[model samples]
Target: MLKFLKIFCASMIASALAFSVAAKEPECTFSATEVYERIADNIVKIISFSIDQHRVLERVRPGIGSGIEIEPGLILTNYHVVQGAKLIGASTNDWAFEAQFLGGDPVLDLALLRVPFYERNFVAPEFGAYNDLDVGQRAYVLGYPLGVGLTLSEGLVSGLDRQIPLNTLSWTTRYIQTDAAVSPGSSGGALLDDCGRIIGLVSMISSHPQAENMGYALPIDSIMPLVGEIEEKGYVSRPWHGLYGQMMTPLIATLLLTDPASVPEGFMVETVEPGSAAEKIGIKGGFLPVMWGFSEILIGGDVITHVNGQPIRSREDALKTVGALEVGDVISLTVWRDGVSLELQAELEERRNFESDLWVNGQR
Candidate 1:
């Protein structure tokens, strides 16, 4: 009888313990297996091709690209994936759903796509904060690598604030660096955090013989807000700020810093093109290019310290502040001039739609 009593008592304790555990919130993780499942559910094969062959072979020789499913049916891929797609007449027309160009810029090498559910439905991949990413940190690379299937690779961030070329007038600017194995088929894949949220998009790699594992990915800081623009306007357009920034160094740190420096730091402004948005907004830009260490760097303009009441801590943050608003969206600023800070408001204007894919006859 004593043994029976003990067993019943233990059973009651176990039940209480189980209930307590169930009542607590769950913990997040960065698991390889779990990340793949997210990719499996989110990644789709982008088949781009010309229909001229569809008529001949009764099927098109579809080119493959990786895409992350954002909102149900909405996928994000590189604009190059759909380059000349409309001209080639790649399309969809059905009753359950359909898709059309939403917003993108071939110059930026970025594109936004929507798929209708009932009208179209799909998951908007969770986004991670790029501000949290540190140089030399470990991160996961997820995507349909080689246009095969969902896969993950591990690498350390090796670079920051890079400019990559896409076309004569187009370039992806201010990107994060990673040493992960990237391939042509990996374009538009997700560079995710441990919790399986996207922090960047695996986009480009250098084919130089002397190049190591250097590759670049566009930061999530640039992508998070784009979701809203595509949804509301079916497109997005904005003018280049037309200013180059340097971070505050221990030397320049004496000057109020508010931007990012890619190397041993000190802040400066350079490359403000005449008549650019930065000019119209009255932001001071550097007049001459200077040399630092072995790098010929641009320097000497007014340093920006804040925007819209937000303290400018890095180049990415400042870009985010301006990039988040529309072309006509107004943004205010506080800048440091020779150590004296001043404030101003600039109604943002459009000089180039760097984020739009709207084109015809291969021209905007």
Candidate 2:
């Protein structure tokens, strides 16, 4: 009788442990149809009326884009969509609500808007880990294209940590590249996982006729850090280096008429923004434009070898080193220019809304 009771207790304990382990595992994976059905209501149509710069008489130009609700009444979209908007509105098929600009970060091309009143108790979707996503994993894009009804397109993740130049400026940030079909009105839409969790925000696409199914999204991890600041402070105060350039390579050295071994590998400084910290420290922009393959590159600029005594080797390395800086922090740069090496120092300052200005002026 004693042995029988002991065996019975052991069996019960094993069953309980098995049940606990199973309960801890995630099981939210849904079918493709279910993902769309669940997320469609949260996807919204963004309409904006802004001043037209091209017209001699300033006229209100209407624009349409897509938005994703991150909270009860908070919408997140691309900053370029409503940069100089006189008025902005968001709507679903059921109801329309007026939206006010909460804040924006032009550097990241992200903006947050607030809706004063909402009809239903909206539940925001969960966010997935962007790092865990494999290159060939399934990805879905949900948005309104050309003011048509909400659409869903499925594709696979093409690449990661891509540095594509969107608009006129080459933004020094990471973008997740996918083969998903993104269109004119798809900006600010959500790149979702199988469980209907947002992994990225659709930002831009390669519209060249030759380029097919090339779309890019900003990873959600990059935006998570700025959410609180953007909500409270109205703008993300980014640490400004205010310098733009390409990474120096052996090919770039050859184009610049220099020996590959003679030129050090680093971030090649092409231009310094006017009135920027780099400008204050006497950094110079390139004047001579030479064709490097299909792109035009300037040669006579400073090649940054190190930042704050940290060796700058790759674009990722440079961004990682400088990205840790904050405004009011003093930074030091070691650059090689005109066959000479120089050390420059400057106190970091706020980057102006130059990107917004360029967009509003129709330069991009």
Candidate 3:
């Protein structure tokens, strides 16, 4: 009888442990249909209207894409989708409304629109933490592909921290690369994680006609700052230091005649705008052009070690540091020059019309 009692107690304990483990396990896996059902109401179809060069009211050809409701009556989409649009209309599964173009960030390919006095309440998607996402994680793309109805496609996070060139603006920006099938009409759709949280907005796919399943999305974190700016100021004014550089590697350091092990990693300055903050502060740009592998790079410029006491480790780090500053704010840079290290200070300037400025400055 005593042995039987002991056996029953062990069985109960084991069952309790099993239940606890099951409770602790995460519910990361989810069904596609369930995700669509939850978010379909917030997904919208955007249509643009404008006048043609012939001075007639014209429906812009292929002026359709997808948008996500970020706030009540406010939707987010791609700038290209609404560019030159005189009138905009948005529709969901059950309702349709006229949308007003609030503002846009062309560089980031983001546009904000509002459906004023919208009667129905909107469910804003929960933004997933971008930094927490990893490659190979399951992802879903929801949009109106090729002017069809709302569609959902599944893929994985194929890459991260990708810098792709925006051919329309002739500038490059970071993107979240995925293998999700995104087509022309799918631009500005939601790229959702397994939890149905939006991690990115579908931007574009590989330009090659034969490229299959290669799509990219603009990470939501990179757009939040611009969104806040647009919400408050109606536009984004990024702080500029008039400096451009490449992240330093061991090979780059050796090519510059520096001991790779001795100096800390940083960005090697390649260009400085004339009469700009960098030039005013005596920050030298590269003088000699050297062929590094297949690419030609400028050498003999200062290696930036820190910005405002924060270590400058990558191009993203430098951009983030400068972007956080307001116009007229002073920033300090610790640089390596002529085999010596020194710190310099410069005031930030507002960068307006970056594309025109890039053209004027002869920067690619």
Which number leads on lDDT?
2
TM-score, cand. 3: 0.76
Model 3 over residues 1-364: C-alpha lDDT tens digits? 0000011122223323432111212237568888787788888899887656764554354378889988888889987788768888998878888888888876666789988645666566888877888777788899988778999998887666664433212122556767778877798899988888889998777543233566778888778767877876767786556666567788777886767887677878778766677888999888888865323567778888998899988777866776578888998899988779998998877755444321211221
In order of listing, the candidates' clash counts read 12, 0, 0
lDDT of 2 by residue, 59-163 (tens): 778888888988888899888777789899999898788899999987778889988654676777888887777666678899987778899998867667665
Model 1 TM-score on a 0 to 1 scale: 0.60
Q: Please list the residue runs of candidate 1 whose C-alpha ends up more than 4 Å from where it truly belongs after superposition.
A: 1-31, 49-64, 87-99, 105-108, 116-124, 132-138, 157-174, 206-209, 247-267, 279-296, 299-347, 354-364
Q: Estimate each model's TM-score.
A: 0.60, 0.86, 0.76
Model 3: which residue pairs collide? none
* True-structure RMSD, every candidate: 15.7, 14.5, 13.9
Ranking by lDDT: 2, 3, 1
RMSD versus native structure for model 1: 15.7
| Global lDDT scores for all candidate models | 0.56, 0.75, 0.72
Q: lDDT score, residue 29, model 3?
A: 59
TM-score attained by model 2: 0.86
What is the lDDT, from 0 to 100, of the residue 64 in candidate 3? 81
- The candidate, 1 or 3, that scores higher on lDDT is 3
